[model samples]
Target: MRSGNPVLSDSTFLDLGSGAVLSRPADAMTLNGTIAKTGFLLFLTVLTAAFAWNQSISPAGPTAAAPIYMWGGVIGGLIVAFITIFKKQWSPVTAPLYALLEGFFLGAISAVFAHLYEGIVMQAVMLTFGTLFAMLFAYRSGMIKVTQKFRAGVVAATGGIMLIYLATIGLGFFGINIPYIHESGLIGIGFSLFVVVIAAMNLVLDFDLIETGVSHGAPKYMEWFGGFALLVTLIWLYVEFLRLLAKLQSRD
Candidate 1:
């Protein structure tokens, strides 16, 4: 179940307290929780923006194109990513900012999809929660363990999927269409199924990270970071599910 950094494991830092150093183990779970909660709040802010944007429309449907505010979310997410990866030292502040950006992106994406497929948003939300809870339960019951090999496989698959998606998007700039994407074809459905599995596995990894953090007794700030990671996975899973369901519906 232990992936990532060995230093993060059992790592202790010193706090300068009244000229005396106090040693404390890193509480990653606390950071994770805080990050997750902050991410939710950020998501709410974006949700509100999405709601306002959608409400301003004359026609209420998917045909209504995603606007600038939606793009803002996407751009914000990218910025957050850059900050998180490069400015790792600023995570205490940057992590929360990343969550807020992620929230807006998710909210905007969800709104767009909800408009297209009637009641699909609710379905996706329920499914997301179900998958998350189910995975947590399984992990807690000793039914699942995130082995190094498993983590490697999942990460590789996730990377492949993201690359393909990015390529598809790039192609659109030249007016190229990748046939199966956004289509209700068998290929599209299969891709969705594969991604869904990957996303679900990611949840397992996230849970492992959280448990690892708690066990190591990481600093309280780590809970936010842990939660943030989990939230990202959940959002990704939810969006994928929503798209998959919509494609199936379109085919029907």
Candidate 2:
């Protein structure tokens, strides 16, 4: 099984796919269970996100989101993600924690964006969910096949995007700007669109991975892992949508 999501990559589910049958069928992963857990994680994320967002607002006007939320969320979320990734068995606990941490960071950053560009957060949320359901439908309907070639293409494209982002961040240390790619110009818009498309494609791969795990009778705890993986992709997708919408709105 392969997925563009780093959390659900090739090795993530290899043992299950390699004919390692579970001794207890009742302890195996289930579609319904995965769905339920995903919903719960999403709820926890939104709950904390709303809390953080509310904390950022005031009667005086929008204020800077506290640095604590940004730094704490980013660092805490990353650490929890790494632990969950390396210890898949810990997902049942770490996954929810990951969502909670991410919510604070997402909320803080989103508040900052919403302050600069009114209505952008709502637009981004709508677009994110719209793309999510659309992609899920396309996958379920077999409109998009997860062939080997498709997986390879998405994996390569995702890697390239990561490299470009890393390079951009590294260059920023020396005060070097990536120029048009980060501006409200055509190139920036196009780049964001490409990233959004790739993010959507990764969803298809994530769905495929979830199905594979179910078919292979992966352990029940994998339900949490599967949900965690989906959340990661959704988070990435949402952030990209925010960037894309912000760029589009900046021109107006």
Candidate 3:
């Protein structure tokens, strides 16, 4: 029931209620409802991403204002995401907003990567969705069970990666850079590959959490929260894939 995703955990459903049934469960959460909400949030993300993408590739090329969109999206998305995490009930309103804000960031970043490597953004997008669907199929087919050990391992690995990233950032302020982790050498490639695998494993955990939420008859609004969590993982996976690809391409 545990998940590497910070937004999802065994306590997620329990925190809503102890019973499998709710008193007014007429519109309780369902797997289908969560799926629909996920699609809608993705649509919102794509819609805004397209706008930012076009802006980045305009005839004038990346403008001085590009950083505005990038930082605005990053800071705004973080704030809204924290709000949704703490106030699950606000997910219905905050989730779509988060997606839209994230789109601004993703589009600008993707554009920058695309400029560096011609077709990298498309490759990353394809691989990201491919990994997502492949993991979903495996989860649905019982090929990958979310056993206690599996959850714990993924959670531990994810925490370790987060700490490494935090250390890198902290050290950055002192003008020191982590050597292999961000470089395009063999060690960096290996590190990126490991992170990609960990990010992919997280999808399986997210799938289990959504299924558990539905089976527990969680409140209808939880569908939005579940979808938001899924979107968060997807975004993370995509970004990791992009980084991995960039590293590989840099070697050329």
User: Which regions in candidate 3 have their CA more than 4 angstroms from the true location?
Assistant: 15-25, 58-61
Specify the highest-lDDT model's number: 3
Instruction: Estimate, for each residue in 222-247, the C-alpha lDDT of model 1 and write its tens digit.
Output: 55455555656776788899889999
lDDT of 1: 0.65
TM-score of every prediction relative to native? 0.78, 0.94, 0.95
Per-residue lDDT over 26-90 for candidate 2, one digit per residue giving the tens place of the 0 to 100 score: 98888999999999999999988887888776655555664667677889998999999999888
Q: Give every collision pair in model 3.
A: none
User: Pairing residues by index, what is the TM-score of model 2?
Assistant: 0.94
Residue 63 lDDT in model 1? 28
169: Cα error in model 1, Å: 1.8
Model 3, total clashes: 0
Clashes of each: 24, 0, 0
Error of 3 at 189 (Å): 0.9
**Model 1, runs deviating above 4 Å:** 1-59, 62-66
